[model samples]
Target chain A: MELLDFARGPALQFALAVFVLGFLWRIVSLFLMPRTKDRSAARPGTRPALFAATREIIRRTAPDKAFGKHSLFALVNGYVFHVGLFIVIIGFAPHIVFFRDLLGVAWPSLPNNVIYAAGVITIASMMVALVRRFLNPVQRLISTLDDYFSWLVTFLPVLTGLLANSHLWVRYETLLAIHILSVELFLIWLPFGKLMHLALVFVTRSQIGTHLAHRGAQI
Target chain B: MTREINVQAAANRFLAQISGNLGAYMEACLHCGHCADACHFYAVTDDPRYTPAYKLFPMARTYKRSKPPLSWFGGAPKVTEKDLQEWEELLFDSCTMCGRCTMVCPMGIDIASIVAASRQAFVAAGLGPPDLLQAAENARDKGSPLGVSADVLADRVEWLADDNEVDIPLDKEKADVLLTVSSIELMKYPDSLVAMAKLLNHAGIDWTLSSKGYEATNFGFLSGRSDIAKIMIQRIVDAAESVGAKTVVIPECGHAYGVLRWAGANILGKPLPFEVVHITEFLADLKRRGKLKLKPMGDAVTYHDPCQISRRGGATQAARDLLDGFATDFREMTPTGNHNWCCGGGGGVQAMSRAAGLRHKVFKLKMDQVEQTGADTMLSACANCRLTMDESKEHWHWDKDLGSLVEVLAEHIDESNAAA
Candidate 1:
């Protein structure tokens, strides 16, 4: 088979299977872990624990006032890259075509320029983030090899996809093939590395949210 | 490595108790460094190692190795003796387990809880602070970390009653309220215990001081020994049960409220039969119910939230409501309530004599917090907080008056309506 066909077919299939199974395995392991019971007398909260957990997922998108000033760069930069990736992935017409062909469904795509702008912004934001990690003393100290590797895999697909669309790379087919391969790499890495935070962040936020809300503090 | 204890066994023991959100929190961390600034130690010292997430290294490292799939990669770093040596200070001396980092993290990792878990592993490895460990031993053996025994509490109560001319009941067979004082109150601040008596008497509540479990403070909880925490809390539980007390009013001790109200049942693997409340919460309820007629004061006052009481304990408004009830000019610290900065001396840090310099150093930030509030009197519902802040105040020679909330509130209880 041609490289493009192999990249878009067997590689995609294998990566998805690994991603799905690994993701589920990791989640199951989390559930398997014993949970600390709050056997203390509880105060009635205005909202139920479940609702509070759901609320905290959105509430923590911004930092609390005391620490907000310090988190400004992280806040804006994080949102920019994440929203940018979402737009580039699902809001672009070609990406939507790939999605519809896979899932048998598609949403409305943004204009080409908008998608291009999002792609550029995502790339820039990611680079700035990586630089921040490289430079900031705290980030530099805490970041592990997994953090840098995850960033590379995540950034490659966006960069390759944008180059393929712009036809600025070696050839359209090769660029698209490389883009698909990069996405596969990201999928394989997602369930194992810190990128697994995609699923676990909600789990963590919800768990703590419930724990605190049950005790009468608003998350 | 310590020769007497097997380090790997301690790691295994700690890994065995990985409960609740431990797995998820370990998986969710991005090492984004957001938790760094959220920590008071890092906030004050600007030290990268003092970052909250870094403190979880030992536990996180061991946890990865304990799990098969993650360890199979051969990439999970081994915990070194050298790493443990540095972490001993990082986990015990610096971080207060205040939960501010937990609150501020975008991923919702319980950074403070995980830090406490790391301390458990260290303590198991025979690496805990000697001061805190000794205090826990005293708490387990003597019924009070400060060695304030039952006879000491009874004699002190008697002396305070005669000195203040107040009705102080002790060891009643049955009472609706069981007033438990911290060792700090019994050993050092007997007047606060007197204040407790005055408030309970003014409310006409059926309250009694149990000689069996008078010390509310639990050093075992601070030292990361859940077994000792259970034993310490069980004394109070048994005392409450024997006395037939419906409510155990935890004195102005933050960690006491934590280990008793929150961790009591979890450590014991059973729910406590009676209610556990902080003195501030009980006082606030009394104020709400018009049980105590407190005369309003004009002095400018603010409250220092003990980490365990306000943020981790979730009784954010109890002290504020009590203060607002009686103070006409009650000022607030920036980021008050659950978001308030931890007084530098919590989480057994105050008990560890070696941590005094760092404790006093970071206390400058807390002093700045109080000074900015422009308050003459800063009251704390947690004696652990008041004790440390008072010491730090002496170090800095800070001019403001620091008082326990219940003690200050005692002065405001209207004498005309007080029960004879």
Candidate 2:
């Protein structure tokens, strides 16, 4: 568990604490921010309406099933990248060791080869999304430097991790340290980036649910 | 039925007709597809060509490539002769100018405005629209969008009085509320008129329907004819002013609500002397004040978000407020409020028969929403949306009742004399 040792150097500790505090602040803002009053009248007693509204929110926000409606390669490849990357993030053996020691909990880690493969796929998919954003006029119009930079920020960890894990570039210790640090940085940025929708989903869903309950509709 | 004008000349005329509006607002588009799915026609048809983006591209490219920095790139996505021909149908026939597209657009491009401009472009090019739009244009020029002349307007109001045994105050000078309605309410949606009358009576509100500025629904909003939109709205503002009505109330038509609430003041060159309240907003106010009472239906009721009244009219919460209090079970359509999908009507597409099939297809979003809800009845606040839902119900055989919020509330209005 020596590698499970804390990168407790003041630099890493400071970065980690700032990341944790900043992430919580973003989540809090989403919860406390007031949206314009929904045009619907508020009726607190309508249980059925609230349930229906809740159910509708869940149904609508559920992931799109008609991947064909989106570009097939984009949708399938994007999902593979996201899902795979998520697995590698938590399922890599070293990550599990760190989590178990630090958080006092751990899930079974994926085999080393699988984690490396997922990282590669994730990097490829990130490139595709970036290229598409640049090439498409509509996407080009809407995108800003911040958006492109965010993608690179996200893709960097996975690309670095794969190189580090496979020993293709640098020593394993150096690459692992960089990967862990970059990940901490990403964690800090998530709530601030467009990724903050994760916090918003709950609020929106609950609002719609409470609203429908007032209308006496079940979800 | 009106005779169709020559398509080529109509397209050219359409361009001339919208030159004024084009000069002002045509440069506002940034081509975000947020407006694309917001359009009922696009939703129903599932046609990318009908998207506000694609529909406006030919014209935008034409102006861009020929006019400025964009012309250096050969006008980014150069428009072809075929694109021009294809766009006539996309702009004129497919769009309803509902302003639903405009409401959802983040940049607020006013795609409906652009569609209106494109329709004018088509008209100028000798690509006249179908019989219904042409008739509406002719009617607008003559007096009403429905071709209801001054004499017919008077007769219709009188017929309403005789038919319902309620006297509609005509041209009353300085009433507290100048209640206005679109032409459809006069021509076919008598039930809406009856509901307004009953509500006004129940609330004991001082209101009068204007005989002079009778038609509140402006076809100019549809055809992208600013002169017509201005003239049509001015007539209502003038009538309301002449009558000294403190507030102007718009009924359940989406475009009419947008005209008065969103664009009315601008058209008049000042804030309207009176506040323009949509019927839903008015009804919500009455309920809030305990002026109107609803007997709970205690049945499964789903709500449809009319593009104009909910999103455009700034009263998305009002309709829900009314429906929530009255229905035993009220379900919301997916993507409700400003994010709600169109009912495949709006703009002037409801009148153009050639676009009906495409319009119906664009309504698939609503149809899918309705299906998901599994509610037996759906309520809407716009006549066109209600009508479009009814048509979708029949076409899809959804076995659901489509109705206006007022109509539903009006039905449940406990007219018990014993309580009084």
Candidate 3:
């Protein structure tokens, strides 16, 4: 019944190993790939400037104006999914409660109602994204089986969490365990899938910023 | 006088040709909107409708829902019914396919390719920009964008040659470099041809322009039909092989550079045995080796990044190093390098008469940046950018010398006939 028991369990340990190893493998592969030769001898530095470049990147990538007509749906829904998902990951009561008991310190947890709302929004946004992909021929052609699977993996945890909250069909503890397991699976998949953009986003943004800055770009 | 358009057949063929590579990229768009600001049309006009993402929407919707029960729901929009003509016009005429949006896309969606494919579909439906369509069809039939006669080319070649020295070969057999030029250079900008010839002559570079494949413009690029593009490039490749050219210098048009540099390997069945360099790259190589020297303009100078040269073509910096020779106060626009704004004349927009107002409006982004720098002169590597910037200066009355990098560099060539 103790929170530390779940943290120290075999499932968590196994998933952590897979996640760490998988994450390293992907990053190394990207690093090792053949880069386009610099035909012009304007040296883009050897040591990657991750922080400085990312700041410039975020500034450029910032939307100057709202996205075009009827585009608010995609933009607003995407933000909700991303922000709400972030809250549930870091602010879930169970996660904080367990951290408090095991690590002797914890961050604040969202109210149970807030967590439920986050879970609902995550599901809603994901469904919209999936529908957009499915109904759009251009999107569908570019989509792969892995993309659909990522959506499933992404949405399932939120769905299961909401189901656990409802406590309608299954026992609360059983559904709660499934939700944790799904979260664990998703975390392990993060660094491998398109989700890795979460970490590489800054890398690309910074690279663009620094390269432009070197070229004397004021923007 | 008139032929009926086969809208459905054209659409199907275009879809089939692009479905594999383009479909792969289209599926990746999470619609993050990162690329919206990067687009020249969107940046200048602040028109959400002009965003690269919106241009691909009709195609994306149809692509996603074309199967089974989804097809029953009418998932994709087609160019067959009423208002389909309007959608075709929007997709084909509105977008320039500059590829700046592709560089900024988080998913690396290659938005230019998507726009190009959509344009190809539009062209299939006979819905391409009237001017662009005329040019493509003309190039398809006449072998040059201006519909220039062989006699005019001969006269221009003769004008570029010095009477006392070596004759510029008309159809020389087996040269080291096959120099191809943009249609503009052939017709309007004789100065570029003269500059290229002078550079070639000064360096003692063994090169010949193909009378057969003299053209550098490929309309398949504008029409979005890869097959047409392939056929157009095949002419250049065949001509290069005929002369056993070890290198090909595609003169400074962004799309021309892109076609020669990127499409060469694909259309030629391998990496071009002959090296393919943009004229800018050729000049940069000469500059780096100290073979070419320039008298610095010693004035405030700014450079505009052409989309094909910078992003698709990757020859922007090479052009800049050459420009550094003359610029006293060299300022760059906010988002330069691969992330720079487009000239808006790309993707046949310059020739697309209907898109002229839009092109001029979109070009203001670069124009404003140049003006803010207080630069009296601007240098661009791509011929299209040079043409567009010149038009911008004329239309907007922005007092600046919009010169091609080659023309500028030729003025600074330190070596003389006696010295060499």
Candidate 4:
């Protein structure tokens, strides 16, 4: 089969299967692991523990005042990249068509210019994150090979998608094929690397809130 | 590697101690390094190793190696002796397990809890700090970490009872409150005990000090030994039950209150038959009930909320209410309440002599916070915080009066109702 056909057929299928099954396995393992029961007395007259957990999952998305100043770069760049990626993935016209084809659901797409702008911002923010990881000594110290590898995989999909959309330096079909392949690579890597954070973030944040609220401290 | 290290055993111990949420925390960390800014040690020393996330690296490494998808790839780097040696200082001496990092983590990772799980592995591997281990042993065998015998505690109680002209009941059966104190309160800050005695007496509360469980500080909890912590907690439970007390009042030691108030149920494997309260909370409850009255202290004072008492024990409002009732000029420190920085002496770091320098170094953040409050006298309910602040005061020759909240309340007690 031609590279484009293989990329769209087998590569896409394999990536989706791995993505779905890998996430299921990881999530199931998390639930299967023994949970330490919190035997501490619940605070009286307080909201239920799950309420605090849900509250934190929402509350932590914004920069907390306690560490806002220190986390400005991380908060800004992180939000920009994540929101941009979300728009590019779900709001772009072609991606919406692709999703509709796959899942039989249709949604209104944003303007091409808006999606393009989001792609550009996402690419720029990923670059900033990359540079910060290399430049900041503490960040560099904590970073592992997997961190850099994940960054590369995460960054390439947006970069290639934007390039494909722009039809720059390559045929549109070829660029599109490369973009899909890059996205497939990212999907394959998602469950194994730090990108697993996409799912675990909700789980951990609520867990932290539940534990803290059980002790009667609002997170 | 000539040294034989049971990395697998240590890994199992760590996994056993942690929960599923911990797995999520490990997986969710982005290595954003925001937690570094939250740690006082890293803030003061500018050491990357002291970063909260860095402190969790060893456990994260082990988790990745032993657990699923990553484990298929030869796992993470093995837990080596060098890692253990390095992490011993990072986990115990530098980090106070203050939970500040946990609060500030954008990913909502409980960094302190992860460090605590690491400490459990260290303890299981016989790698816990010697001083903390020794203190835990002392508390296990001698009933007091400071080695103050029961007779010594009884004598101090007698002396305080005679000095205050009130009967300090010891092991009194069927009391309303079973008041337990730390060794620091009994030894270094006897005046706090005196203050508590006066207030309890003046309020006409049926409270008694138990000789069997007088020491509230649990070195096992500090040392990360569940067995030792359980033993220490069970002693207090037994003492409280034997006295048939409705409430067990933990004195002004921060971790002491945390051990009994929070961890007591877990250690005892059931709900405590009696209520556990901090001295500040008890006093505040009395005032709220109009059972105890206090004259207003006109001095400008700021209250330091000990991390454990306010953040962990949920007694922040109680302390504030009590302080507001008595101190007409009560000033709040910036970033007060649950977000207050630790006094750099908790988690048994105060007992470890080797950690003194690091503790004092990290104490600069707290010192600056207190200085900004501009209150000459800073009152704290935790005896450990008070002692650490006093040490910092002497080290820097800081011209500030560090007083206990209970003691200050005792000095301003309203004696008009004594005649009744």
For each candidate, what TM-score against the reference?
0.97, 0.64, 0.71, 0.97
Error of 3 at B119 (Å): 1.9
Winning candidate number (DockQ): 1
Ranking by DockQ: 1, 4, 3, 2
Those runs of model 2 whose alpha carbons end farther than 4 Å from true positions after fitting are A1-219, B1-46, B77-81, B97-110, B415-420
lDDT of 2: 0.65
Compose the digit string of candidate 3's lDDT tens values, residues A1-219.
544347348667777787777767645644454433223222234234454465566664544332334344655666678898888777888778867875799987888888888888788888988897787443554454446767788887888878988896788777777877886788676655556666555444554444433323323
Of 3 and 4, which scores higher on lDDT? Answer: 4
Stretches > 4 Å off in candidate 4: B1-8, B418-420
- Residue B403, candidate 2: how far off, in angstroms? 1.7
Docking model 2 quality class: incorrect
List TM-score (chain A only) for every prediction.
Answer: 0.96, 0.77, 0.79, 0.96
- Candidate 2: tens digits of C-alpha lDDT, residues B318-388: 88788776887888767667667777767766777676677667666776787788787778878877766
Winner of 1 and 2 under DockQ? 1
CA-lDDT, candidates in order: 0.85, 0.65, 0.67, 0.85
RMSD of candidates 1 onward, in order = 1.6, 11.1, 8.7, 1.8
TM-score of chain A taken by itself, candidate 2: 0.77
Q: How high a TM-score does candidate 4 get?
A: 0.97
- Tens-place lDDT per residue, model 4, B232-260, is 88888888889888899999988988878
What is model 3's DockQ versus the real complex?
0.08
